[model samples]
Target chain A: MPAPTRVFLSGCSMMILLIGSLAACVQTAPPELLEAVESLDRDLVAIQGAEFAPTEYARFVQDWAALKGRMLAEEDVIRWPWEPNPLAAHLQKVQEEGEQAMAVATQRKEEDRRDAEARLTLLDRRLRIFNSRVDEMESRVVLGQRPIETELLVRQAHSFLDQGLFARSLQATEQASTLIVAQTALLTTELKRYADERLVGTWRQMARRTIAWSRTNQATAILVNKADRRLTIYRNGRPVVSYQVRLGYNGIMEKRYQGDGATPEGQYRVVKKRDRGQTQFYRALLLDYPNAEDRRRFHKARRAGAIPAGAFIGGQIEIHGEDGLPMSQTLGCLMLDNRQMDKLFEKVEVGAPVTIIGALKVSNPVALALADLEQFEEG
Target chain B: MKQPFICYLMVSALALAGGCAQPPTDKLTTAEKAINEARAAGAPTYLAEDFAKLEGMLTTAKREIAEQDAKFAMLRDYDKAEQLLAAVETDAARVNTDATKKKEEAKAVALQAQQAAQEAVKATQELVKKAPVGKDQKPLQAIKADAQGLIASLSEVQTALDAGDYRVAQIKAKAIQEKSLAVQAEIQRAMTKVGAAKAQKDKQVKKHSSR
Candidate 1:
């Protein structure tokens, strides 16, 4: 062969040799990559083991390094010039592969994160509920009332609330209220029979009868703020003592019959205070709520089976002192703070005559005065 | 005439070499390689990326199932997720099922590339613990630290699975899932510990025990 032909032949042979060597070099990749991949798989599977041992992380890193090495080898093959752009088309392909892996990993990480977040949210909500329960307990103590066994129920409700369980909370609250009411009603009936029979029936009739007597005898006016749960004694525009009290769960105008949950919206008197310990929840404060008018209605409802047979309504109701419990949770009677009730107990005698107002519609003094001034100016 | 003929012969040889010579085969796709890498890395999103389409369908099915409270509907969703999982497993089964066929060897090896993809899907189903906060920003060091810990655990699992130790893989997977809760607990404990150091200005929120 001529010198020029020899050079040309050498160049072609070299190219072929380089290509073969590069192919051979790349051939090591699959097994190496497989090893790296297997290492990763081992680490992942280990995570699912009992007691996720954090020590496994170290092994993962070592395996990851091996994977990176294999990736580099493939890259080297692609970059080799004699290998005819071994890494060219393959680089894009491998990179895409990397991208795919990354995508899958990212998705799994996100799902894990969201699950964690949900758990955190649930925990926070439960904590809030716990705090609320503690608050309720404190309030009950402050009011000097008995503690009921609703802690477990409340805790269950809290659990539900933590899981965004609003309906469950409502149901639990309703249930708690129902049990309390049933118990209170039973005690009230027992106590009322122990007191005056003539005073039994509906609050409206009781209010009318009591107010008629108080009006005739001339009694002191009572101011009740159902919203703030306060009852104030007033004589000739002078504020006497004001006591915080708990009213019906529904603190509005008193309903005449059952399920009204309202404090009576009319005037009534404290006819008597029974010195008997009545219900399991509290002591008795028998007030003359449904007097003669109450009896008339009670008989009517009794005929109708609306008030249940021989249900006495008035004897167990009165303006009384705290029942030595935490909260002022009561069923229709006026519950006063211990100190306030003690003071009242001394100052007033039985039959001193008290009037009950349904609502306290006091105008904001600042706003009312301003309006009055404006009116005066206009006038 | 002889030089011309030799030139023609060289050209024909070059043509024959170019046409007959296989450039490359048994080369994996980028997606395939990525699936494998993600499988090893234990990166859930990477595992799930290729399954985005299927996952999207699954999510819709899940939402529909969630909307109805009927037991039948809930079972349907469970079945759907199971069906999809079975399909993925079937695709992966190809790698091991036809091991004896010589003609199917290359194809089997090629299908083996899908094991990584299947792994990605499995990893995608894993429950999440923590996520990065802020828009288009990387997670904080604490968050990343937790993730790194989880990643490490998952990687070990991958290794075990590759070694064909199915039991070890299962154990590892379970461990990672359990420890994942620690990250959030850590964050909360840390916050509380720090909060305790601050001025007790927060109104002694009345803690009520009675409901």
Candidate 2:
């Protein structure tokens, strides 16, 4: 009886020991933890966790390593299945921490991206408006390298954005935008004279008179609108058509003297018609630019110290052809492409009236651009 | 007396341990100074990618130091942080060298553009001199004004170059060159018109005499 009892007890003790050893050797993990960690990994990369939430991400990384180390160490231990597996609970806690970090990272990234994108959009619009005004005044030479610098900054901002450095990109764009705003302010102020309603009314009235002259005499007339960048022909009070024309480099300003780069605002007559060989502008209708009114204004400006004492009353203003030049800016002249000039050259004879004005429409493209610039400045 | 002796030994041991646990502040300062010098040398503009990587190294080093700082003093370690800072310093020196070289190249380019712009302005001025007299005078004067504008922009380029803003100088000089070329084209067109008009005037004079 003693030998049999001893053998049974020994076999049962061995069985229990082997079962406990098997339980301890088995590496058990919460199944959902794998999927949860993987999901957090994806979001972490997507949100640039290392960049946006570096400290938290580093902590998560350290916890992950510790959990793996604990799991590996537990593989050699012998314990009953009833014992609580700390690895699973540790993994669950680390996963929760990691998930929390990823959530914060994603939110921060979205907020920074939104802020940077809005700034970029505003800077882009400001640049476009600045460029337009530059073209309008042909002020490229005046602005020097500012436009180029602003453009480069925008390109760099886009590069930083591509690298997910939103704050740095925003800083670069903000610097570029400051220059654009200053330049635009200067240009808008320079061109503000053209927006004066009283001056515009005078120009419009002068244009109306020229059209009335055409309708009364059943003859052709020419109207140059600086703000519209347009030259329209009226045959017997009806607008025959319009063509895109380039004015002076500083054409928005009323002409004062020679080399002023202003297209004079006045009524005139096409005193002579010079066909291609007769004129240097490909073909030309020479105009009386400094009529009595022009001389009177020039004298007044000189007396007021606005014009230099040595300045001459500029002459030879004409309606002319572009002759295939790429520039749209003219020297106080109404310019047309050679093909358009051919049509215009045959439409009117010498002495057909021509009137030049600042603006005929209140909401021309240039005026609208100035208004947009004001809104930008107000912001 | 024995307890006081034991306390002195512990104090010395703890002091040694604390010294070992301290962050490599001197290395961090050296690395930060190097980064600043690199930035001042225009590394951010010319060696942008390499500079960015260097900056990333600095951030990592700072984080590593911060990690150690958050640990118990007796357990803190700065060996990894010290390595990161050393790397940053080395890379920052390389970036500074590359950026200076790039800036010199840009300066040379800007000078070349300035020469081209100057030549174009001269050529355009010559054409303006030969432009037809009566009708082209006003327009030719305007062209001269444009040439003057080009000259003024060349001055701007010089100012930027003098300020060590080679990129800005290059941009200004290039713009001047482009505008000068356009003005030259315009003057050539005017010269052709002048020639044509002279030929026409000759033909007219001959016809009237023949009739």
Per-prediction backbone clash count: 95, 0
lDDT of 1 by residue, A109-150 (tens): 455445544544543444344334323222222111111223
Looking at model 2 chain A, report the run of 10 residues with the lowest lDDT sum: A322-331
For residues A25-102, what per-residue lDDT tens digits would candidate 2 score against the true structure? 676777688678767766675566767776677666556544553454455666566778676788888898788778
lDDT of 1 at B200: 39
Off by over 4 Å in 2: A1-106, A122-149, A183-187, A211-221, A229-246, A249-253, A292-313, A324-329, A337-352, A372-379, B1-211
lDDT of 2 at A46: 59
lDDT: worst 10-residue window of model 1 chain A: A138-147
Give the per-residue lDDT digits (tens) of candidate 1, residues B1-211.
8999999999988776554532111211222443344344332222222222222323333333343334442122233333333333342233223322322443344234334433432342342232222211122332444444455445655685566434334434544544445444554554454355332323232233332
Q: What digit string (tens of lDDT, one per residue) describes model 2 on residues B1-211?
A: 8999999999999887775677899999999999999999888667654565566667767877898899877778787778777877987898889888997898888788777867876776676666542333234445555666565656777887788877666655655666667767777776677677667767876999999
What lDDT is reached at residue A162 by model 2?
Answer: 65
Best by lDDT: 2
Candidate 2: what lDDT? Answer: 0.74
